[model samples]
Target chain A: SQQGEEDPQALSIQEGENATMNCSYKTSINNLQWYRQNSGRGLVHLILIRSNEREKHSGRLRVTLDTSKKSSSLLITASRAADTASYFCTPGGSGAGSYQLTFGKGTKLSVIP
Target chain B: DVKVTQSSRYLVKRTGEKVFLECVQDMDHENMFWYRQDPGLGLRLIYFSYDVKMKEKGDIPEGYSVSREKKERFSLILESASTNQTSMYLCASRLAAYNEQFFGPGTRLTVL
Candidate 1:
């Protein structure tokens, strides 16, 4: 399975603090993508990092990928109460059938105001 | 902007009743997918259509069927709703060249 498993199934933090979540996959991937979902809402794409790239950033969110370790991490700087949500990662691959990115149980985040 | 919309944000149905969940995307994406989200199970793909009249079963396609009669519309049909089928159904669409998927608000289905 090329599924990306997120560590620390849940996390809690105070507003304005930084929150980090880790994801590890079993096999090599061409790229990796992260998504955020609010309570009872659909997921929103956060960022994507390719194999040749080590890090990418979007607004206050930063993502890093280590191909050698087959792991990726998402860092949210200065987390806000509105940032309380679940984060998910999915492995990306090449080929005609690589579009069906399967997701794993995500890391649920809680930011207290 | 890419927008995916589901028929309902919440749905309630009794066991053995037929259910239909509709999804529409305004981006004219070539790929559309249906998935069910559950606690601890993440998101499991139920079905996906690459183009009109093209459908493929995903990891968990049992008890679920899909129809893609038009480019922007994809419908998921449950022949006989069951208690185990109760879940949050999500619809997503993506361009063929991109890996990022645009998702709908999701429909929370409750089966009694």
Candidate 2:
């Protein structure tokens, strides 16, 4: 199973605060991607970190991958009300059974204003 | 921009009714997928197509089916809609197996 399980199923934070989420997988991966989903909208890709990469950043979002540990983390800096959304991690690779894209249960983040 | 569109934003159907949800992508991607999302279960793959008329069952494909007769279109069908089938259906398309997938707005299906 390439599924990544997100830690801290839910998180609440105040505006301007930084929130961090972690994900752990049972198997190795070629790449890992983080996504954000608003209340009822489709997922928007945030960042992708390849297995060889240690960390990647886009805007305020930072994603890190540690294949040796089969774990990943996503950090959001200076959170805002508009940043309130559910975050998910997906692990994909070139190996068989990686095409299914089994996503994690997700971490629901609530940024209070 | 990669564009993926679904046929409906919300749909209501009764049990035992045949339901059809359609998705279309403008990027002409060869890989398309269907997934169902619930409150706590995250996203579960229902089916995927690698090419026209080629479909593969995903993690959860018991009561669902998919069709890809054209390169740009994929459809998910509920043979007999059930109450348990109520979920947010998402469609995504990828240029290749390792590329990031572009998702549609999603269709919220309510089975009564």
Candidate 3:
């Protein structure tokens, strides 16, 4: 399985603090995406970074990808209580017409207000 | 807004009984996928459909099968429910392989 493995299975931080999670995969990927899931709910896509891209940001979320290391990281700055949820990293392959993604066990983040 | 709807939010079945889970997407997506999420296993793909009648097996397709008779609907079938099959099942759809997928609220199945 070329599934990505997230570091720090769980994290806790006070509101206004930064939270960072890392993911490492074993194979080359075409893109990596970050998704957030509320308790017992479907996941919502947060961001997508292509293999060629090194870094991207959206609002308080920042994503960095390193193809050389087959790793990526997600940074949430000034996280709020609402940001308490599970985060997953999905690495997509370059296969034609194959949009299948391998998801890793997510990082559970808790933001205390 | 893209919306994916599952047939049920919760289901219970007995061993040896047949079970069916339905999913429908309103986004006219060309790719649809079914996955089962377990506590420590993350999300494991069960099956996917690329077109109206084209279906493909995913990583763990042993005891599951799928049907895609229409573009908007996909169905997962468990030939005979078993205790080990209890888990949360999720349905997702995307316009293409690289596009962001929209997922439905999962169905939590309990096999007894």
Best by DockQ: 3
lDDT at position A68, candidate 3: 98
Those runs of model 1 whose alpha carbons end farther than 4 Å from true positions after fitting are none
Which portions of model 3 miss their true places by more than 4 Å? none
How do the residues B1-40 of candidate 2 rate in per-residue lDDT, one tens digit apiece? Answer: 9999999999999999999999999998999999999987
- In angstroms, how far off is B102's CA in candidate 3? 1.1
TM-score of 2: 0.96
Candidate 2 vs 3: which has more lDDT: 3
Per-residue lDDT over A15-67 for candidate 2, one digit per residue giving the tens place of the 0 to 100 score? 99999999998877888988889965568888888989999999999898898
**iRMS, all models:** 1.6, 1.3, 1.3
The residue-by-residue lDDT of candidate 1 on B20-71, one tens digit each, is 9999999889999999999879999999988999998988999999999999
Which 10 consecutive residues of model 2 chain B have the lowest summed lDDT? B93-102
Rank order by DockQ, top first? 3, 2, 1
Instruction: Estimate the overall C-alpha local distance difference test score of candidate 3.
Output: 0.91
Off by over 4 Å in 2: none
**What CA RMSD would you report for each candidate?**
1.3, 1.2, 1.3
Evaluated against the true structure, the overall lDDT of model 2 is: 0.91
Please give, for every candidate in the order listed, the TM-score of chain B alone compared with the true chain B.
0.98, 0.99, 0.99
B37-62, model 3: which lDDT tens digit per residue?
99988999999998999988889999
